[model samples]
Structure formats: structure tokens, C-alpha cells
Target chain A: MVKKKLIYLDNAATSFPKPEQVYQKMDHCMRNIGANPGRSGHRMAIKADEMVYNTRETIKKLFNISNSENIIFTSNATIALNLGIKGVLQKGDEVISSSIEHNSVFRPLMQLIKKGVRVKFIPCSEDGFLDPDDVEKAVTDKTKLIIVNHASNVTGNITPIKEIGKIAKRSGAIFFIDAAQTAGNISIDVKRDYIDMLACSGHKSLLGPQGTGILYVRPGIELNTIIEGGTGSSSESENQPELLPDKLESGTLNTVGIVGLGAGVDFILKTGLDKIRNRKVFLTIKLLKGLENLNGIKIYGPGDAGKIVPIVSFNINSIDPSEVGYLLDERFGIMTRVGLHCSPLAHKTIGSFPKGTVRVSLGYFNTEGDIDYLINSLKNILKTKA
Target chain B: MDKELKEECILVFQTTHRTLQAENILKKEKIKIKIVLKPRSITTDCGLAIRFNAEDKDVIFKIIKNNNLSLMGVYSRSGEKWIKL
Candidate 1:
């Protein structure tokens, strides 16, 4: 029995084959510095504490955050988004979000709606492009927050976040960006972009292991603490500490996962973000061009390759997306995602609701050869259907 | 032996994070410091403290002030007796 080569195109879900340094650092941390950080005075514990702080500092540099303490680690981006959204909004607050938001932001905002908070969505074009003017028009004096997904996970369409950020600033509404799909794939400056709060998944674009995520809160944003417990500081006090990270971060952190995330950030810094983005864009263009000529295939998103992340969504005429997904995997040993991609709002906006579309999300590790193989496999699947 | 240990002082912090941070800042400034278990005579808010030459007290204070570390207290040890400086 021979094993077929695996081509992973599900990076938008969670990155695979993380950089070698991520694995190495995780292993080293577990073996050498496994002590619970901020809890003990032992050398191992201190080392663990340092590693966590170093990761925060790395995140600060990567995101252009001025203060390291503003970055909080969570289990994943969903948890981070919950913290960002729920912590800031109060009753009667009006929140504006883009049409293309993952369940991470959408579900949280839905929960907020039940709490008497009003939520409005800025509509995007069929190609998932969001006009900054729509976002500006949606802003009201009662609009306390404006949340935008930096990029669409399903269609890979990049939103005009800087323009929206400016509108949010001028309107005096706090701007929160969901960078789950864009953190490492593109450049984001929390300061220059006027982002007051940002959430991201370390496991996805950051190239870290699962169970790692980040939330950046700008200074002077007095967010209510959502989850409260022992922060390993102010143990004498019965209340949580009133400090930057200690105020937001409670309980013991994921030290091993954080160290790995730090290593992943280090790798990104060393390799350079522009180089990674260029390669991913080139491969996506190649894939899009290859599939453009195929019959019965309708590609989704902006279709301009460079305007989006390295993700492509499309469908075969009259065929269920899941069926196409299954055939792509079993027949060709290629892995891709199907269905709504966890953003039903995006699907409905793009007219792929209910059935959804076949999505191929490329990563920095994927090559032109991989794109060619995916195109050829897609062609073979289409031929069989005919 | 008692006099030799008495020449040093321990700077205790409220949290292990701050204790480690203080050590890093002091080390970078070339100030000799050692992370030691908090002396039993000192209040144990955090289990660790920075031990350095008592003569370097002013320089240590400057470093802590520059870094804005939240220190619990500073105490000098003399033959097991902890004296608040």
C-alpha cells in the first residue's frame, strides 16, 4: 500500500507544517522550562515567565503595538474575539461590522444583540469587496464600536480597513479588527490603522500550534474584564489586578504554546512579511488563471488575485460543494474546505448560501507546482462529471 | 560569614514577573545581581527577590525607577535580621 502525496490547501482554517523553529521551541519549552509561569520563584518558573513576556514583545513588534503588555494570549481567535467584543460594548451601544465576518465576530455580536446592543452590517459587493463609504455611512453618534474582518476567510477579499479605521476614529467609535485571516499574510499597524482593539489566531497565519491566539488592546481602552481569576499577581488581593495584562489575562497561561508562537513570530520577522505575501499572491494568481478556463467552474471573490489573500472559492455547475471537496481529496490526495466556511453571512452575501462553495486556501509553504497539481486535479474532476 | 552576607540587600517584588524583569534590567545595566529565595526574615509576597551589593543600592533604585517596576520592599539582612532600608 503506497501513501499518496498530501497537498494541504486549508490554511485559512489553521496553518499546517509550522516553521521548524516553532516545533523546536515548543519541544524545548516543554522539556526544559515547563514550570507554571508567574507562580513560582524557581529558575524554571522565571524562565517560563520570561518566555511569555518575550512572546508578547514579539507580538508587539509584529503588529506595531507600542506596549507589549497590551497583547493578551487566549486559547484561540474565537476566545480573543469574544474578549474584544464583549469586553468593550455595553447596553444600547451600536456596533458596525462588515458583511464578511467569521462566526468568531458574528456570533459574538449576535450574543451582544440579545443584551440590548444594536448591530449593523456594512454590505460588501458580490466579490466581497467592502466600500469604505458604506462603513462611513453606517456610523452614528450611538455607534460605540466598529468591527471589521481584515480579510474575508471564505473569498480572501481584503477589506479597506485603514479607511474604515479612519472613519471610526473621526466618528469617535472604537475600531476593532478581526485579523484572523490577515495577521501574517499581510501588514497591519494597530497605531497607524487607528485600531483600538485587534484579535488574531496564532495557529493560522502566525504559524503556531493550536490553542494559541492574541488580542491587542490599545492603551486607554478600559475594557471590562470578561473572565476573572487568579492572574498570579496581586494574590493578596481578592480582586483581579488593575494592570495592563494582569487585568485582562487571568489564570495560568499556555506557556508552551506561547513559546512556540514566539518562535513562529521570529520566523516571520526573519523571512520578512512582504516576501511571504508576494509568493502567496503569485501562487494564487497561477491557481486562479489555471481554473479560469475550466468549464462549469465559477470562481468567487474579487478574482484579481493580488487584492485578496491566498484563498479561492468556486463551485462546479449543479454539483454540491461537498461532493467536489470529497472527490478532490479521495481521488487526488488534495485537501480543501467546502460548505459555508463558518461564515454564513458571507455566503449569503456572495449568493453561495446553504450549499456554499469549494474553497482552496494557500499558504507560504505552498508552491507553484502545488497550484498546478490542484488545477489539474480540479480539471480531472470536472471531466468525470461531464 | 555573617558580615559577608550582611553586605547584600534583597529587593522583593509583588510578582515573579516583576522579579524576573528587574533582574534583566539590572543585568543589562551591568549591575551584578542574583535571583535568590526571599529571605525568611523578609515578608514573602513573592517567593523570589534580587540580591545585590548593598553599596549598589542607589544604582539599583535608579534602574527600578527607570523601568517603573512595582517593588514590594527593600530589606538589608544582618545575621538573619531583615532591616527595611
Candidate 2:
């Protein structure tokens, strides 16, 4: 029996083959500095505490955040979004979002609707492009929060976040962004963008291990605590401490995962985010170009690669998306995602709802050869259908 | 014993995050400081504090103030007793 090499194309879900440093640092943290940070006075515990703070400082630099303490770590982006949304909004508050939000933002906002909160989902174009004007038009004085997904996980459509951020600032609404798909793939400056809150998945574009995510809360945003417990501070007080991170972060953090995240961000900083993003863009362009001439194949989203992230969604005529995904995996050893991509609203906007499209999400580690092979494999699949 | 430890003061913080942050900022300035357990008598938010020479008190306070750290207070060790400064 022969083993086949697997080609991973599901980076939008979670990045694979993280930077070598990520693995090395995680190993070093577990083996050497395996103490709960900030909980003990031992040397290892102090070292662990320093490592966690260093990661915070590194992330602060990556996002152009003013204060390192504003960045809070969570299990994943979903948790971060939950904290930001539930923490800030009150009854009768109007929150606006886009049609192309991942369930992370959409579901949370929807749940708020039942709590007497008004939730308006601004519709996007067929190509999943969100017009900033629509967002501005939806803004009301009652609008307390404007949350938008930085990029679509399904179509890879990049929203006009800076313009929307400006509108939120003018309206005095908190501008929150779900950077689940854009964080490390695209550069973001929380200050310049006028973003009051930003949530991102460390496992996705940040190239960290799973169970790591970040939420950046601007200074002066008095968010209510969603969950509270022991924070290793003010031990005598029965109430949670009113510190920046300790106020929100209430438990033993994922120290090992965070250490790996630090190394991953360091890799991005040293290699340069633009360089990493450009490489994926180059490969994505090649993949899109290859799919253009294929018969009976319908490509979705911004057909132009430059207009979106390194993700492509398409479908073969007369075939179910899951079947296509299965064939690609079982037959060609390629891994791709199909079906709604956990974003039914985005699927509806792109007219691929119910039976979604096969999605190929490229990563920095993916090569041109990999794209060519995918194209050839897709071609083969199409030929058999005919 | 080092002359610096002969007369020492502990800088306390509201959270361990600030304590570690101040340690980094002070260490970069080549200021002598040691992270000692929060004095058993001092009930502060954090379990740790920076023990430095009483002579470095002014400089340490300046650094903490410049960084906008949430410092609880400074305490000096007078013999076996820790007195709040």
C-alpha cells in the first residue's frame, strides 16, 4: 500500500503547516516553561508570565494597537465576538452588520435580536461586495454598534471597513470588525481605521495553533464583563479586578497556544505581512486564471483575484458541491471545503444558498505547483462528469 | 549581601500584567530589580512585586508613572517590618 500526500486548501477554516517557529516555541513552552502564568511566584511561572506579555506586545505592534493590555486572548474568534457584542450592547440598541458575516458575528447578533436589540443586516452585492454607502445609510443615532466581517469566509470579498469605520465614528457607534479571514492576510490598523473593537482568529491567518484568538478593545470602551472568575489578581476581593485584561480575561489562559501564536506573529513580522500575502495572491491568481476556461464550471465571488482574499468558490454544473469536494479529496488527495462554508447569508447573497459551492482557500505555504495540480484535478473531475 | 538589598522597597501593582510590564521597562534601563513575592503582610491585587534598592525608588516611580502603569503603592522594608511609603 502507498500513502498519498495531502494537499490542504482549507486555510480560511484554519491555517495548516504553521511556521516552524510556532511549533518550536510551543514545544519549548511546554517542555521548559510549563507553569501557569501569573498564578505563581516561581521562576518558571514568572518566565511564563513574561512570555504571555511578550506575545501581547507583539500583537499590539501587528495591529497598531496603542496599548498592549487592550488585547485579550480567547479560545477562538467566536468567543471574542461573543464577548464584544454581548458586553457592549444593551436593550433597545441598534446594531448594524452586513449580509456576508460568518456565523461568528451573525449568530451572536441574531441572538441579541431576541433581547430587544434591533439588528439590521445590510445587503451586499451579488459578488459579495459591501458598499460603504449602504452601511452609512443604515447608521442611525440609535445605532450603538456597527459590526462587520472584515472579509467573507465564503467568497473572500473584502469589505470597505475603513469607510464604514469612519461612518461609525461620525455616528458615535462602536465599530467592530470580525477579522477571522483578514487579520494576517491583510494589514489592519485599529487606530487609523477608527476601529473600536476587532476580533480575529489566531488559528486562521495568524498561523497559530488552535484554541487561540484575540480581541482588541480600544481605550475608553467600557464593555461589561460577559464571564467572570478568578483572574489571579486582587485575591482578597470577591469581585473581579477592574484591570484592562484581567477585567475580561478570567481564567488560566492557553499559555502553550499563546506561545506558539507569538512565534507565528514573529514569523509574519520578520517575513513581512505584505510578502506573505502577495505570495498567496500570486498563487490565487494562477488558480483563478486556470479555472476560467473550464467548461460547465461556474466561479463565484469577485472573479478578479485582486479584489478578494486567496479564496475561490466555484461549482460544476449538474453536480452537488459535497460530491465535488469528496471527489477532490478521495480521488486527488486534495482537501477543500463545501456547503455554505458556515455562512448561509453569504451563500444566499451569492445565490449559492442551500447547496453551496466548492471552496478552495489558499495559504502562504501553498505553492504554484499546488494550484496547477488543483486546476488539473478539477479539470479531470469535470471531464468525468461530461 | 549586596548593598542595594540592605535598604529595599517593593513596588506593587494592581495586576501581574503591569508588574511584568514594569519589570521589562525597568530592566531595559539597566535598573537593578528583583521580582519578589508580594510581602505576606501587603494585601495587593497581584501576587508579585518588584523589590529594588530604596535608592532606585525615584527612578522606578518615574518609569512606572511614564508607562501609565496601575501601581498599587510602594513599600519599604524597615528591618523585619514592611512599611508603606
Candidate 3:
């Protein structure tokens, strides 16, 4: 029996089949430089340390960050969000976040709410687009931070972050962007956009393995350390070092995963983000058009296809989303995400509340043929149901 | 026989990783450089520094500035003594 081909359409969750360079660099790190970084003076340890720093430099260049030390690595975007949210907010401080935030940002802010941090949710339309004017109106004297995701993971709608950033800056609020869905796929400059803090997952758009993420803090933005321990620097002092990265990053790091992330960033740099974005957009447009032509389908988000990421969420008439997801996987050998996608607030915002959507998120590796296959599979499923 | 005196400079960075980064940048510019253990005269941070020809100070400084390498300090070495440059 011939094995069926597997088509992965879940890049928004975690990108699959990372670049070849990422795999090679990760293997090389494991074989050659496998040691604790920043802890020892031995040759292998130094090599490991270089690997970590090299990744930081690569990330800096990619994000147009001035100080590489401001970028701190974490296990995932959730941890990074926790650090950013918990580190900055104090009692009686107000935070403005969009309704389309992932659970990673939502859960942390909820915890802060229990501690007296007031959070105001800027409403998004059914298309998952937030208004910058609403953000401006939401600001108050107590507003300490404005957090928004660059794009919605469920609907793929790109938020107007630059405009919101300007509003936050003029209001003297620190702007924090969750770029888990936009990093590597969108061009973001911390200085030009007036972003004070950014949190992103290395596994999503960055194409690195899971368990890697980044948080960038702008200069002079003092965030109290949430997790503190051995940073491999200032060993003599029991207190945590008062530096940028060492202050944010404590304990041993994931050296091999970081090396892989560096390679992934290098690939993005060499290939150019514009080219990658264009490719993903092309695939997304093709998928959207195909889905639009299909019968009994309800598509969500800014359906224009040109105004979003490569993610598309929809539900077929009278068909449960989980059933569609199951059929897509079991019969068609296509992988996709179904239901709330860990962003129940987003689902509710888009009016997909009780039941969710079947999300088909594309990546650079997905081909036009793959989109055609998905469309045909959906058409077949609809025919069977009819 | 007279011994020839040579002037050398050491670029100290906060971490060995940064010292290695400086080494890479200088090498790419074709400046003569080497990774040396942090000299005893200087305060030890990460136990590493980059040694290069003092005559290439202008070029090396340009490289450091251009790359934004986190350099702790620069020191010059004379006969049996190290002086801050």
C-alpha cells in the first residue's frame, strides 16, 4: 500500500518541517557544542556560549533591534507573555488589550486583574479587526501598558499595530505587542513602531523547534525580574545581576534549541521576509478564493485575503468543526486545527463562540497544489453531506 | 643585540561570547587579531579578550562601532605594564 501524503496546514500553532539549515545546525550543536552556555571556561562551553550570542545577533538583525541584550529567550511564548505582563504591571496600573488576544496574553492579564491591575479590552469587529481610535479612547492616566497581538491566530486578521503604537506612545503608555503570529512573517521595527516590549514564539513563524521564544524590552523600560537565579554571570553575588539579558534571563538556557532558532532566522534573512510574506500571501489568497467558491461555507476574518496573514478560518453549513477536522485528517491526510484554538475570547469576538472554526494556516513550504487539494477535499466533504 | 618593542592592544568585552564576536568582526575586516586569555592586569569578567595590532586602532574601533559589539574597555600594553587606551 502506498502511503498517503501529509499536508500540514497548522503553521499558526507551530510551524512544521522547519528549514534544512535549522535541522543541520541543531544536530551540529548537539554533536559539537553540547555544554552549558555561560557557565564554564572550557572550549565546548565557550562554543555553546557563542551559539547563544550568535542567535541573539541574528534575532537583533531580523527585528531591527539595537541592543541584542534586550532579547530574552524563554521556553515558549506563554512564558514570555507571563514575564512581560507580570514584570511590568503594578497595583492600580491599567492595561489595554484587544479582544483578539491568545490565551497566553489573556491568562496572564487575568491573573494581574486579581492583583488589582485593571484591564480594558478594546473590541474587535466580527472580522477580528481592532480600531486604533478605540485604543486611543481607552487610554487613561493610569494606563501603564497597551498590549495587542500583531495578528489574530484564529482569523488571521492583522492588527493595526503601528497606529496603535503611536497612540500608546503619545499617551505615555508602554506598547507591548504579542508577535507570535506575525514574527518572521511581518516586518516589525521596535524603534520605528514605538514598541517597548515584544513577545513571540520561536516555533510559530520563526520555524524553530518548540520550546523556544523571545521577549524584547526596549531601553530604560525597567521590568521587575519575575524569575531570577543563576545567569552564569556575577556568580560571586547571590543577588541577580542588574543587566539587560542577565537580569531577564535566569537559569540554564536551551542552547541546542537556540542554535536551531539562529539557523531559522538566518534562513529568513537570506530568503528575505518580503519574499516569504508574498509567497504565503499568494497561497492564502488562492485558498480563500477557492473556499469562497465552495457552497455552504462561511469564512471569517477580513475576507479580503490581502489584509491578513496566511490563516483562514471557516465552518461548513450543518457540519461540526471537529468533524470537518477529523475528516480532513483521516480521509484526506490533511492536518488542521479545529475549535477555539486556545483563544476563546477570539472565538467569541468573531461570533464563532460555542462551536469554533476549522483553521487552515499556511506556511512558506505549502504549495498551491496543497491548497487545491484542500479545496477539493472540502468540496468532496460538502458533496457527501449534501 | 637589541630587542624590538612592539605595541599591542587588548579589547575586553563583558562576556567570552562577545569577545568571540569581536574576533569574528575584526577577522572579516582582515585586521590582524587573536583571541587571548584575559590578562592578569585587567579585571576578569569572562576571562577572554581580543589582542590586535595597536596600529590598527582606527580600523578596529570602526569595526566595533559599526557592529555594535558590546566592548567593556580597551587597554594598551607597554614594557611590563598595561595602560588604559
**Candidate with maximal TM-score:** 2
lDDT per model vs. reference: 0.87, 0.90, 0.88
Q: Candidate 3 — which residues are off by over 4 angstroms?
A: A1-3, B1-11, B16-21, B28-32, B36-47, B51-85
Candidate 2 to native Cα RMSD, angstroms: 1.4
TM-score of chain B of 3: 0.86
Off by over 4 Å in 2: A1-3, B1-4, B44-46
Docking class for model 2 is medium
For candidate 2, the lDDT comes to 0.90
Better of 1 and 2 by DockQ: 2
Can you tell me which runs of candidate 1 are displaced by over 4 Å?
A1-3, B1-6, B10-19, B36-49, B64-85
**Where is the poorest 10-residue window by lDDT in model 2 chain A?**
A1-10
By descending DockQ, how would the candidates be arranged? Answer: 2, 1, 3
Candidate 2 lDDT over residue span A145-228, tens digit each: 999988999999888789999999999999999999999998899978899999999999899999999999999998999899
The residue pairs found clashing in candidate 3 are none
Question: Residue B49 lDDT in model 2?
Answer: 91
Over A1-386, each residue of candidate 3 has an lDDT whose tens digit, in order, gives 34668999999999988999999999999998899877766767777877898899999998899878789999998899899989999989999998999999999999889989899999999999999999998898778999998999999999988899999888899999999999999898898888999999999889898989999999899989889887766555678777778788888899999999999889999999999999998888899999999998999998866789899999999799999999999888999999999999999999999799999999989999999999998998999988
lDDT of 2 by residue, B20-81 (tens): 88899999988998998898788844478988988888887888878788788899987888
Models sorted by TM-score, best on top: 2, 1, 3
